[model samples]
Structure formats: C-alpha cells, structure tokens
Target: MGISVTHKKLKVELVGFRLSTPKHYKIDGVENIDIERYDHEIFSKYLSILLEQENVEIKKKIDNCSITLLDYSENEISSYAFGKLLVFKSGKRQRIVNEDDLTEGEFKNRDQGLKNEIHFVINKTTGVILVERDYEKIFKASLLNSFFYHNKNFIYDYVDEFNKLNYNKETKTSIEIHKNKLIYINPLPSQDLFDELEEFARIKRFKVTKKVEKKKNHGIDGCAKELEDILNKASNTSLGQNVVSIEYYMDERGKGLEMDSLKKMIQNIYQSHYYEDFIITGTNIDNDLKTLTKDNITKRFEFKIPVDIDGNYVDICILFDKLLFLIQEYIEEHFDLDDYYSDKVRNLIVNP
Candidate 1:
C-alpha cells in the first residue's frame, strides 16, 4: 500500500489553456499534421465544453482569465500528452490554399496581443504549476503524484481536482472534505485525437524509395535491402551495446565513461565493420568469421576488409551493405553472448 496524501487549503491560480487545430493532410499514404494552425473556433468549442463540465459560473471579470502559455514546446506529441497554452502571433500571410491563407509565422509574441492561447497555472495537484518560468525543471523532474505532470494517470480533459480535510475528532478513520470550488467533473474526450496524430506523423515519416535494386544475391542487397540491413544493424548494435552490454557489462554501461566505447561499437555496425571486434557485435566469434567476415579478428582488432572490394557490386549507396548485412544476419540467427565479453562477475550474462 502507498502512503495516503494529506493537503491543506489548496490555493490555485487559473493560468490558461490551448487546443490544437491541425491542418491534416494525407500525402503519399502518410499523415502531415501541422499543429501551428491557431483555430479560434475549435479552441472556443473545447473551452465551452470544459466550462460546462466544471459547472463554475465564469464571473464577468474572470471571463478573460484565458492566459496564453508563454513558454513550451510546439511538438505534436507534447500537445496531446502534456497540455500547453501556446500563444501565436499573426505574421505575414505567405500562401493561399483551398481558399484559406496559410500564415508562415506564429512565434510567441507575449507583448504583441491579448490571449491567443490559454494555459493554466494551478498549484493544486502539482506543487509547482506548469508556468512559463519553471518549465525546464518540471519537464524533467520525477513527480508521478503531480496531477499536471502525470496527465495520463486519469482519463480526463483537465487535471482532476479534489479537496482534503483533517480527520474528524469523532471518527478516527474518516477524513472530511468540506471545501468550495474544489470538486471537479470528469474530462470530456477530445474529438479524433489519435487519428489526427497518425496522419501528422505519417507525413513526417514519408520516405521516397530509391530505384537501386540490381539483382538477387549480387553481393550487396541494393537500396531496399540496404535500408533494411541498416535498420537491423543499427537496432542490433544499440540493443547489444546499450541494453545487452549493460546487462553483461553493468560496470562499464553504468559509468558515463563507457558511452564512447559503446558508441564506437554501434558505429562499427552502422559503418559495416561489425566483424571488427567481438566488442562491436556480441558473444559469438566463430560463426561471425565463418558466415560474415570469413576471417578471425585478432586480439588488437587489426584493420582488415571483410569482403572482396572488387567482387562486391551494388548501388554506390550500398557498396558496404554486403559486409554489414552478412555480419548482422549471421548474428541474429545465433545471438548467444558469453560473460567473457564483460569484465564483471562470473555468469553475469552467460547467454543474452
């Protein structure tokens, strides 16, 4: 069981909030989401819903309580996961598309306008409000119990609010909560949030296939195979050095000094030098020489080419792919690492 939280008179300062109105585009079977677009109508609609859910009457004076968040990242992921009160400024409108003029600039101009975006500053759930001043510390700090920080903890639109009171004198086990403007309602789900994100990210990840394929088993795998090989080699090396290396060589992995050694291993695989040394790949050495390099790596890791440079043929982009692919393919099928690689305790990672 976890420790029960206790709170005193939880004071609050309503900051501001902003909602994304992305210009969605599906280009070449990929999403191109543009979160910079400031849709006043969408923001107004979401605000209306939030206010209704809160059930608190917005006094005439506090009607303009919406304060644009002065500082935060405009990243698509950050907007959905953690909330923002991004303020956009109307710069020079550059292009016109589908009858709407696309403006090029919306960089934060606090002194330029009244509130364009509204991000709130509240200290109720989280001890420190996600204000413009202390965003750096709050963003990196480990505050799981903090409501504003752990937005995904509860499925709600806004931070869940609650009031806690001291234990009643008559009842030892009962805690009383008699506070005003403290209890809040559940959050209303946003409209098609993930769908918008999928498209946005798809556009961002759209890749152009290069016509680099020459023939099958023609030494290098060509463009397509090179991309695949590159991905595999990069992943395998990262897994081995960053993850597997640590499991086996915890002392080296844990220390900040080991990053250079591990990084070189990853670079070796990336640059088609996986057979350079056992340190770069993994525990197996015999299979590496038989299947990939066809030569044993010496104790000093002497420089030697793994394949016939003249015999190998492929797109200039993937001339080295042959050596890297063979090295990677051989290891994937036989990935048994011994504890000998790491200078740690015996049997630390005999087989990973």
Candidate 2:
C-alpha cells in the first residue's frame, strides 16, 4: 500500500454585518484590482460603507487602512469561506474563481483585491469613526491610562488629586486638550498644534560660552584632523567611533572638474574604505582651497554640514559611531526620548 499525503485547505472566517448596496457594484472582484486600486478612493468608499453597515465606529477616520496580506493563491481559501457565508446567509454562491485560472500578473492583481475585501470587512469590525471626535477622546484616555500604569510613583503621589479632578471642568479641559502638547503619530506629528507644543517644550535657557575657540587652520587638512579628533573623543567615551573619510582633489582651472572630483572621491571611498558600519567625513569639500584645508584639520566634524543644509557645492563625508549612539541621542533629545530610544534600540538589537 502506498502512503498518501493529504493537504488541508486553510479556512478564513470573516464575521461582520453584510453590506447591501442599493445597486450591484462590481469591485473588479479579485480578478482585476491591482495594489494601486486597493489604495484608491473606490476601495476606501467600499470599506466606509461596510463599516457604516456593521455599526462599527472606529475611533479614527477610515481615510486609509493598512491590511496584512497573504499570497494570491491563499485568497481562494478566504473567498471560499466568504462564499460559504454568503450561501448560508442568502442561499446563493458568491462568484469566485480558482487561482490556476489566472496568469501570474493577474494573480497579484487578484491578491490585491482579496486584501482590500478582507480589509473592508476588518474596517467594519473595527468600527470606523472620525479622528477629531472619537479618536481624540480615545487617545487621551489611552495616554492617561498609560501614564497611570507606568508612572506608579506619580500615580501614588497624585492619586487623591487625580481622583478629585477626574471629572472636574479644569481637569477635563487640561487632560482632554488635544494638540495642546506634542502628539506623536508614528512617522509624523498629528497636527500643527502638536508641532507648536513640541517647539514650546524644546525651549530652554542656553548659556553662552565666554571664550570661542578660533581654528588656526581652515582647509582640507584642518577638517580631516578635526574629524579625527572628534572620533577620538567619542571613542574615549562610552560611545565607540568609526571614521569614513573622503578626499577631493581638483586642479584650479578645469571645467566640470569639481563634480568629476566628487564622483572619483566617492568611487574611491566606496571601493577602498567602504565600512559597512562607520562614520563618514570628507576633506577638500569647499570652493576655496585654503578654507577646505583649514576646515579639514580644525573643525569638529558633524554628520550633516552647514554647506549641505544650504545646498552649496561641497564634498563631504560624515563621521559617526557604528553603534549610532549620536543618532540615538539626537532622537532622545528631539523626540519622545524613552519611548523612541527603547523602540529604536529594540529594532537595532533584533535586526543585529
């Protein structure tokens, strides 16, 4: 007797109030919708309708929703499950096709459609709502909960005060205020109010140095030496340092020589000293030879130079630690220090 292997088909269960449009709306139906189409307005409208019908009120508006997706072939399994629900509910089969019927490109397109469909159902279940009204309240509540949960010392200290002000007008005004303080929303700040709050929080008293150190040298050699010194100092501290140096050489009278020099310098750096993990710095980075030489030896090297910010023509390399302690410090100083650093360190450790 021959041994037989039987593969089990995956079953995806999606539960929500079914959307009943006034008229039949064809949504490219898993065969024609591309990834772009899934992100388009039509798909979002479809999602909004499904959400509305399901009585799901999301705290945030459903302007866009990101969904996890599986392979195109797997869509058939989900569709089959959906079809089963439709049949059970309405005594009819939902139109679906097997994966083998479509070409490779078509399969991807179909997969996008499947993702959109699944997202539509999920959005409905999650309860789509506007961010201004619902999400703001939810977010404030979540923040207070988090503050209470983590800051046990503060919570204990202010427990009586917190309880007394829990529902009071003044407390409500302060606590429920949106964008009155910095509000971080993933990649960007939530609003201009949040940005203003960030700026306000960043305001601090600065003490002026009585003596400013004047550089004796002001060219490429000076810049390079200065970079080396900074790296040396950083290495002396807990932060470890790595140096990536670029040197640009050009004769005074050549046309298009500066760009060519930069290109050659970059190529040389890439070919010879391309440290997978290191700080980058450059020499002979300005129009004036004397200035370039002096800068190379005397200036404390920065990851980003003033010239770069001003969009001036210059050759430059950045010197930084392999561990990115400086970058980490910058994030901490400028953003939600603890939370941001913890997340970043977690990612670095995991990835490393």
Candidate 3:
C-alpha cells in the first residue's frame, strides 16, 4: 500500500529590523567596524559568538538554546543568511514500553525531550531580520535585544522599525481582522463643541426644556416660561459631538465577537458621544474579514506568504532556505530603502 501525503498552506509573516553598529562597538580586539562595511569575516565572527555556551541564552529560561547557520547567498544589493535557533529542555523523565514484554511497560524511567525551532533570515545590507509571526511565543523583539546584549563582541545591533510598514489607499496587500479579537476601543471627538451648539438653531429649540421638572409655583401663564427655560437649558446643557479617531485591541486569549455586532456598537457610540475606551474580554475569533481601516491598526499588519507543507517530519532549516529568497524579494518590493536611512529612523537606533 502506498502512503498518502497531504499538502497544506502555511502562512509566512516576517518582522523587520534596521541594522546598525554602535560607534563605540568593536569586534574582538579590533577597532570599531564601520556600519557601511560587511564581509564574510564579520559574519563568521558574529555567528561564533552566538554559538558559545554562555552567549546562547536568549533569556533566563532559554539559556540552553543552540543556533545553526543553514545557508548563505548574496547579491550586489544585499547578503542573505538563513539559520535555525533551537530551544530544548532535557532530563525529562518518562516511562517507555519494554520490547521484551508486549503487554508490560518500561522497567526504568528514561529521559524524554521537548524542543522548539525558530527559522529566520538576516539581510546584511538592509539590516532587516525576518521570522514567522507564529513563533512569537519563542521569539520576541525583547528576546533578540537581550540576546545581542549578552555578547560584547557581537558587532551589529538591530532596531525594529515596524511602524514604517504603514499602508496607503493604493496598497495591494489585503488585511483581515476579527471583530471578536478586538479587545479595546478608544474614541476621540471629531466635531468641536460649537458644532454641537449649532443644533439649537436647527431644532424646535423648546425640546431642550424636556428635562426641566414641573415648576413648584406657577410663574408664567403660557409656554413663554417653558420657552425661557428651554433657552436657558439650551445654552447651559453640555453639547455632544461625534467621535472620529478610534483605537481597538485584542485580549491575551486573542478572541472576540462578531463584526456585525461591533459595527453596530461603534455606530451607537459615535452617535451618543459618551463612551471612550473599552476592554473586551474573550478567548475566540470565530470569523474574520477585511473590514478594518489603517487607523484601527496598532502594529503594521503581518505580510502573508504562502508555503507548501508535507505531512512528515520537517527539516525546518531546508524549508527556511527555500523561503528566504522569497522573503527578501518581498522586502525589496514593499519597503523603501530611503526610509531606513531617514533621520527619524536613525535617531531610533541606539548609536545614531
């Protein structure tokens, strides 16, 4: 019988970092290497330092991790390096079946292992690093910062310029969001108080007195007193305006309600002009759609790349190598080189 293999689509997203060297930095005993210059020697030395037992710790808990370089290639514009970072916990005790007895389990406890791998790409010239968003649990911006900080001889440092990945009205990339995943909302007034006051001249003008209680004593014979009260109330009553600028968030569980329900609620808030911020607590995103605007985004949205997966034990290093060039191409097509060198981005770097 032939074994059946299933193929599936895996979504790929990468985060970018602006690479720079601190002015005071040095490699080994040599003087500071210029940020503009890079060669194989510098890359080799940097990788050696990270492979050290002491320098491998990405964090307090992940100290036993190991890193391996799988492939490297470069062009006139950029040099690409692909690698795998492996984290494992050893000495886990578990019982196994004894081959001698079919019905009986292991006589002695044995060590079982737990492992995780994060595949990444580094573009030397662009100073951008790419890793899938799914591995966010094991890989984080702070973790990378801490890892680089662990080694003094590591010549290059990275600055995450994710906000630069903003999209305009003309962008072709599609963005999808779950209304249920939205956990927070902040609404700011878009109309001025004077705009609300203009309503006085437009309405019956006497409806404003609807809130006034019945007088204790009859002071006027007609609606003139009511009209006076209306005028006073209309002048003193707080004016309400519509909210335009708004923000939304997702909870720890990454869950939320239906988009239809969210839209209705927003419409109500916009008209009432009362509510501001909200913390929605849920643990599910049942459905998703491309309904959010750029203003509602907190982080630059993840870029989706499609990958083919085989239903077998995967060689992640090989897989990442194949995808590295594709990711580099995506970066080249979407990001502007000038943005990385802009004064604003430079100030964001530690040594600039």
Per-model CA lDDT versus the true structure: 0.25, 0.22, 0.36
Worst 10-residue lDDT window for candidate 2 reads 80-89
lDDT of 1: 0.25
> Which stretches of candidate 2 lie above 4 Å from their native place?
1-55, 59-97, 103-183, 187-352
Q: In candidate 2, residue 80 scores what lDDT?
A: 15
Model 2 misses residue 345 by how many Å?
25
lDDT of 2 by residue, 244-298 (tens): 2332222334322233333333233222211111222222323322121111111
* Candidate 1 lDDT over residue span 1-352, tens digit each: 8996432221111211122233333333443433222323222333334334322222112121222223222233221212344332332333333435554544434323333332332211111122221211121111211222122222133212211122223543221111111121111122222222222211101111221123333212322222443334331222222111111132333322133334333333323311212222222223221111111111110112222333222232232232234333333443333322342311121111
Compared to the true structure, candidate 3 yields what TM-score?
A: 0.36
Give residue 38's lDDT in candidate 1 (0 to 100).
Answer: 30
Question: TM-scores for all candidates?
Answer: 0.16, 0.16, 0.36
